[model samples]
Target: MLVAGTTRTAEIEGISAAGADSDLLVHTPSADAEILTYGEPIRAPVVPVSPSGCPTPAVVTRAVRELIGLDVTVVDGGLAEPTGAPTVTVGARPGDDVREQDPVSTAPGVLAAAREFGRAVPDDEVYLAETIPGGTTTAFGVLRALGETPTVSSSLPENPLELKQEVVRDGLTASSLEPGDAAGDPADALRRMGDPVLATITGLLVGLVEGDTAVTLAGGTQLLAAAALARHAGVETTLRLATTSFVAGDESVDLETAARALNVDLTVTDPGFENRDHPAMDAYVAGEAKEGVGMGGALALADAAGVPMEDVRERIVTVYDRLLDGRDPAEPQP
Candidate 1:
């Protein structure tokens, strides 16, 4: 199973089915392996040199090629280069300005595409992940709108916590003002601020389902958000939480909390991140990331694709280990 969309600085996470050692594994496609990438500046303030998008591309591509033992195809869906070399060049900077449509429509489009792909895949199962930067904030926004205190921040709730506070307030304010204009459409919001990848993911999911492959969504907050939306909209899917991501702190997004809200059982893959050497866990402490929605999802797909869990774990451990070794990708790039 493979699914990847929604990435931010570092693309820290991908997707997953469960935490550690689950039956059906999940994973996400890397930018290098993606059919393509797309996005437009939505006036959201972004930082320079912050390393945007998921970090799984190199790992996922490497792991898939080595573990799954195949040279996967890579394609572009129009927005090949959006004035940014990966999300690292233009960071979302954790703010409300970064917008993505509700994905109500986009989800269907992605699902449609995914359904088709699912039938083509040799496996009978499928997994999904997201690549939305600042997607955590959006998840908080959606959750809060649904009337859940999903976040708690000491400094006004932290990055996404604060972001959610603002968004929820704005959404509430908008609803109060409009009182009838559908308040706001997540799809429109995504279109205005969301990257093209979001739509692509949804389309893939839709297509895969049409193909008859059993589906398990993988990702941290975004997947949860998408699952909630899909379920509410009558989209049938088996949901799983890729437990390997450090994208969301337990305090901020328990996912369990979100699942309870929807009255759904969230299956998970592996709990490998519990190891002291896990890079994702360290990323959170380093303040580089606060959620693993994407990471969780990506790992799941890797597992399903038959990538050895040890190899996946080793790859992540090494990536961060490499970083700690002072070997930066930006070492002059000579």
Candidate 2:
């Protein structure tokens, strides 16, 4: 099962290049979760795309899930808009700017509730993913608070490293935290610098591990931040971090190094999008919208299931074309 968590942090200007319209960035997560669950966005008029017209990674995720028959659960970690897709509510409000104090004041309660939900999941192995806009900034903040100097991944081809650094620096100062201040207290980091999605995933990881459920964290830096938090909280269980080669190949951030620092096993999958004729696939090759909505993990699972990379790329094109036409290609035209 893939659990997708949505947050409002994506609304931060110049922070995320996830959506074409800056105003719709908050809805990207909802729209992503919707597409992952239903093959097309139900609330938004169209599927989320980058400013460059590159499709959201959720398209890739949806195709993989269809081919591999993976189930998905959306979590309302904090949503500005209610998703038409079914979701699990974890008692969290939408996160505020991390530069503000108490960005996720309800984080403790959210963590506890999500832990219960994680324990109740029947799946022995769960794949945790996220869809927050500006997530890399929050991930950076959380990691810094936990004493790690992380180069977080971005959805854009060129990561806005300077802007993210400024944001994290201000956030830490605003919260009166120095690097590693929350090292011994992971929840404290969530209360100040983290988003609800981070808290939810960390809690879920702990609960899932305690329940003896094998788990794979499916994303790049965001999942790595959650893993770092879980480790600080004393979760010694072996965990796997899975992502697409786009993220691994990104020179803007070092995912492999962070994974090693966190001591989590890392798996990177090349979905063979580069060879596709589709513009959406080409966008991935060009380094736009690198990874999110469990795209990387979906690809890894597809590989493990022996699904050919060519087949996966073909399905991605099918899904993208379906979204483009606003209907499945398999459906008869009027």
Candidate 3:
């Protein structure tokens, strides 16, 4: 089973280039969760896409889920709109911009709720995922608050490192925290500089740590931020991270170094989108909407299950074609 959380942070602008435009960005997370549970998004005619028309990674994740028969549970960490899929909500409101202090004022309560929610799950092994617009920026804020100079990735081909750094700096300054000020207190860092998704994921990881169930933190820098917080809060459990080759191959950031810093075992999967004929796949090869909604983890799991990448690609094409035509995929392709 995969537990995917959705959130929103106002710092998405100037840092992330996820949705097709500013108006669609806030709907990205909800649309992603809806697409994962149902075959298509209920709120919009098409799935969210990058500015270059690269479909949201939710298509990839949806393909893998149908191929492998994986069940998904959506977590409403904080959504700007409601998802058609049922959700376990941990937060009652969306997060404010990170540039302001106390972005997630209900951090402690949200964490506690997420911890309890995690403990209630019956699965022995789980894949954790997230769908948050501008999540990387908030992750950077939390990481910086905890004293780590993390080189996080962006949804766009160009990393926008300077913009992210500026956002983090403003967030820290507004929160009155210097780098490392919240080092020993992980939850405080989240409260001061993070989003509901970070707190929820951190608490979920911590809750799973106390049990025998194995957990894989899925996604790139965002998951790293959660794991870093979990460890800083004294979670001794070893974590496994899964992401796409796009993130691994990004020259603008050092993902491996950050994984090593958190002592996490990293796995990178390539869905072989290179040179694909589809418009969305073409944009993906060009480096847009690289990883989100657990695409990397779902791809890795499919590979382990002896599913061919070609099959996954075919499924994605089917989903994308239907999406473009304003229709649902009704059923998985054989």
Highest TM-score among the candidates is held by which one?
2
Candidate 2: list runs displaced more than 4 Å: 1-8, 326-334
lDDT of 1: 0.39
Which candidate, 1 or 3, has the higher lDDT? 3
Taking the tens digit of each residue's C-alpha lDDT, what string does model 3 give over 291-320? Answer: 888888999999999999999999998878
TM-score of each candidate? 0.57, 0.94, 0.94
Per-residue lDDT of model 2, residues 219-268, tens digit only: 98888899998998899877899999999999987777778877899999
Q: What is candidate 1's lDDT per residue for 126-155, written digit by digit as tens?
A: 555444334555454444444444432211
RMSD of 1: 9.7
Of 1 and 2, the candidate ranking higher by lDDT: 2
Clashing pairs in 3: none
Candidate 2 residue 88 C-alpha distance from true site, Å: 0.9
Error of 1 at 81 (Å): 2.6
